[model samples]
Target: MKRKWDSSDERYFGIGIYRPKTVENVGSLWRTAYVLGASFVFLIDAKYKKKSSDVLKVWARIPLFQFETIEAFIQTVPYSCQLIGVEMDDSATPIQDFFHPDRAIYLLGSENNGLPKSLKSKCQELVILPGEPSLNVAAAGSIVVYDRILKKVNRSLLIQ
Candidate 1:
């Protein structure tokens, strides 16, 4: 399900998985991000270390942004883009109800604890998937990314 990279950056949204601590999750996330046509993935507190020797590997080809702080990550995004924090909060609507943004960032948090309360406060929107107490970080991320892409693709048909 790898996506052919778009020549021009227009219309597609971005996926940001906040602070994943496992390499397995990172690999799983990489595959989904590629399929969803996300511009890049921001990995906060990424656990694996990248040795200089790993430069030419397939993982290196993927866009991975590691930030020291969530504030720094937010700063990197353009103000024009929308940021949605995925978490289980009272105000959050189901992922299906959240509107797909023309330029967006989907934030998936750490496995043990969800997105930090402080970070959640900054999000323009928050979304939740029902019926489960929790989800594996990678699985939750894939669901959100796929759902967003599906909604956008469906919406396009109505415009034509």
Candidate 2:
């Protein structure tokens, strides 16, 4: 049977994984981002093409950027794209009420520590998972990517 994922987006956003400890997780995140129409996937403070995960294969198609630091990566984001942090913080807006930007870079922090305080301070917006304690890095990033695609698709339908 044909799948809905065959669809495309005119303006695709990006997703990122920050210092992920496992190769498998990053590989999974990259695959999800690719399947969901993300324009790119990025790595922060992590070695590029050093792991034997399936990520290298996916990287062949989707552009992946390696940043020396989160600050450096944040600086590279286009002004038109909002840097949204996926973290559970007291000040974070619940994902349900938050407005997914038309162009966004959804950043997921390390799986063990969540987002760093310095990175949190820099994000334009922080979105909380709510109810769940937290999710594994890849799982959380996939949810955010899926949410963006769903909202974008629905918005386009309304305009038509």
Candidate 3:
């Protein structure tokens, strides 16, 4: 039987990078995502080499989708999922203030250049982590995921 989606029901989220520059970062992010309950991980316009940092072999536990272009990635976003872009843009909402959606795909940009205007335009919301100099892409993604988990837990506590 098909079940209807409910906001209070189990929620799922995924995190990914756009044109990621290093294999180690990808592996680290993948490991963290799996540990933090991400339903999946993905890459857009990038490829990753196997890295030892991913000792958990998270790839076997969760799915990783690779898309050659932003459009391709956008097309595959699950229905009712929001695209939350993590960036340092001035207009972005601080991670602490941003209420994560029940279903979301968090997209982080490449380490050096960050997300392009074309891609940022497509994001439903842009969020910024707390920091001055830019953070490593993997680290930024980890923080975002951690924030989401933390907020979700806090909300659940309130409800209980």
Which candidate wins on TM-score? Answer: 3
**lDDT (10s digit) by residue, model 2, range 1-160:** 7675524343658888788888778788888888888889998988756355463477777888889887799789896778899998899998888888877888899978888988888789999876777788899899888777778789778877
* Model 3 ranges with Cα > 4 A deviation: 1-8
Which candidate do you rate higher for lDDT, 1 or 3? Answer: 3
Task: Write candidate 1's Cα lDDT for 1-160 as tens digits.
Answer: 8768552345756676677777777777766787667777778766555443443453555587788788888788786788888888899988767887778888888887879988898889999987678888888889888887778778766655
TM-scores of the candidates in the order shown = 0.84, 0.87, 0.92
What is the C-alpha lDDT profile of model 3 across 1-160, one tens digit per residue? 6878544586899999999998888888998999999999999998776665566778899988899999999889889999999999999999978999989999999987999999999999999998799998999999999999999989988887
Error of 1 at 76 (Å): 0.7
Residue 111 error for model 1, in Å? 0.7
- TM-score of candidate 3 relative to the true fold: 0.92
Q: What is the lDDT of residue 70 in candidate 2?
A: 76
Return whichever of 1 and 3 wins on TM-score: 3
Better of 1 and 2 by TM-score: 2
1 or 2, greater by lDDT: 2
Q: Give the distance in Å from residue 49's predicted Cα in candidate 1 to where it truly belongs.
A: 3.6
